[model samples]
Target: MPKDAMAQKRGGWIACPDCDTLHQCGPVKAPHDVKCANCGRTLFTRTENPLDRPLAFALAGLVLFIPANLYPIVTFSFHGVKTDNVLVTGVYRLAEGGFPGVGLLVLLASVLFPALYLMGMTYVLLCSRLRQYPGDFALTLRMTQGLNRWGMIDVYLLACLISFIKLGQLATVLPGPGLYCLGGVLVCTLLASLGFDPDLLWRRFGARSDKAGSWNLLKPKAS
Candidate 1:
């Protein structure tokens, strides 16, 4: 039987993340990237060292996160007086201005959530690299996904730029060390998420096809 036909018989199929087209999932030769059949988008590439890339990203994110919250993101100068704003100061300013709701939102999405997200991702990657189970691996993976969406460092950066433009006429706005660190944080976290493959973790844990959920939709059938 043809590979695709046999895959269908064995319920080993995978849906493309981009186009949702079903394809028989099977092991490809090492060092080749997999592409979606319908849209031809790259699905996952085989890396010479899978754990190294993701682990490096996660560590970099964690390192940058500290400076992101510590240094002043921007400084405003008016009439020769200057004021610096760090991550917490921004949140406090929002609250003091009577936008308590917005303050809380900024606190969670920008400050606390991003920290947790980075830490969680770092922990997961470390555990996977060590080949050691860290509590419930699947549950940690799901939680990390939720945190990933909530971390809005990029959105915060956009807001800072808008504020700089609008406030520039009234005061001189200068990007600070914190602003650059935040940018680094965003880049590192994004790269970490992109490099890590959840399917590899599932397979490592010995999950059966039935337990693979949506991932099994692409499994190639055995010959």
Candidate 2:
């Protein structure tokens, strides 16, 4: 069954990040540099190694992710009333306050997606470092892409800052360890992305199927 799925997998075909132009780049060499024919945008460059800087940042992010979730984001002291808000508590309170949809979005954007992205990157990079192809490479790529897109820790941070500012008028809102840890995670995630190239996965995946090229993945797949 895996073989059959692998057989159907096609190779090549990349998109320009700038102008959305599609290019069919057959087989690229190491230091895989390719420019989009339409927009002159560099699509894929540098065949990344898992043991490089990207891996380091990703590992660091994973380490910080734990405390970011466990620790309190902020401590609110209002007229001798002390309330410490952890990340999960914030989500729970939001749901309990009749904003379940927003709470769910917050949970996914702030907590679940960020952790999944870090884990996914670590897994894929480690597997590549060991010269192992994932069971379903395309699915893994899609998952990571979705996770990356949804991981909105920055948004959460913004909301926290706004809350701090607004609440500070009437109460003392002290920044907690979780806030600092989350900042570290966000920085690490950005750094990891700067060095890691998902396109490198295509180079390895192309080995299995070379008869045709990948179609327009920008379009959503049919259910």
Candidate 3:
């Protein structure tokens, strides 16, 4: 039999997300992580409060996201005159100053993508907690996972710090409430993503892989 057919025969095999190596899935005690044999990437772990932990972090990230965008991220002072700028301001300024592409990139990376990610994650967690899968569950979940790289708030925050250091010699730059809030959002979103378990979601929701016609390892059994 082919490898895929062999995988089907194994009954409880899981493909490694990193290297596509199939490993038989077995229940393990808490505090132990399931690692991929080929790539050594962690596939799963017995988390005590999987849903609750990520849900809390997602909620916190959503809350902080509001203030992160609304308030000024930082303030710049030149010759005693000060000006504060929010997240969008930098994008607009970048566009107005002739870097429209960079502005749009920043807008998507810093503002748009983070908001979508937070909302998507919040919705997914809510549905998972309620044991209900909405019509758009799969699409939403896939998009949330896909945008993980595009949501670059951490990178944006680091850029802010670098700007602060570089501009300190010419003028004064101070952290604002929004900057702190953005930091909080970044931290919360990161924790939420880390704590989130896709396998758990698949098992609970009976999510099927559209690509793999015969793969149903995590498919929930009918009652």
Candidate 4:
């Protein structure tokens, strides 16, 4: 018969932060706070809540993503000549304005990155919920981390706001509702990514699947 998968063990001896004493803890089956057995120092406790929190955020992101992609992210008026551009449209405008390089950069930063981040996050959340053990959990974790860096929708929004503020009289600029919705989605996705604990995936699935450990082992140990 195949060996039993390594499930997360709940009860264990945790090192006391204050006294350096090892304290026996009961099963941490839920999110709560516990005290060290010897020093009574408070310690964080968490259960296998799965990916419910992240899933909720991902769903919210999906909802907001519609507007972010559908409506204009920025609107500009120069001498009463109004022009509105969404994320992709901005890239096209930049290219047409003889800034092909900048257009490519913006396309990668604002369009591709945000979409990839959302899709990756959604995949991870759904997979975790289904209890489907990914062959490379570490790869998924790294993808999520990469997504965090690439999600620049919020930054783009800020840039638009700053530009609008500075060009108030010369050329009026206004943000569209899509911009606000995209901003919301960006924030929610970030929060969801941060709150997601990759360790939880290993716990629910199995240890052999944790590639993070391999990565950790490759790193030089601290003195």
| Model 4 regions more than 4 Å off | 1-50, 134-138, 208-223
lDDT per residue for candidate 2 within 1-223, as digits (tens), equals 3432342234445567789886666644445667888877778665444247778899999999999989999999989999998788978999999999989988888889988888888777777666677687567766886777799988888888999999999999999999999999999998887677776654445542433444334777899
How many clashes in candidate 3? 0
- Clash totals for all models, in order? 6, 0, 0, 0
Best by lDDT: 3
lDDT (Cα, 0-100) at 137 in candidate 1 = 71
lDDT of 1 by residue, 75-192 (tens): 9999999999999897798999999999999899998888887777777767766768857777877787688789899999999999899989999999999999999998988887
Query: Whole-model Cα lDDT per candidate?
Result: 0.76, 0.76, 0.81, 0.69
* Candidate with better TM-score, 2 vs 4: 2
Tens-digit lDDT track for model 3 on 160-181? 9998999899998999999999
Model 2 segments more than 4 A misplaced: 1-35, 40-42, 47-51, 207-223
Off by over 4 Å in 3: 1-11, 208-223
- Compute each candidate's TM-score over C-alphas: 0.76, 0.77, 0.84, 0.68
Worst 10 residues of 2 by lDDT: 1-10
Query: Whole-model lDDT, candidate 4?
Result: 0.69
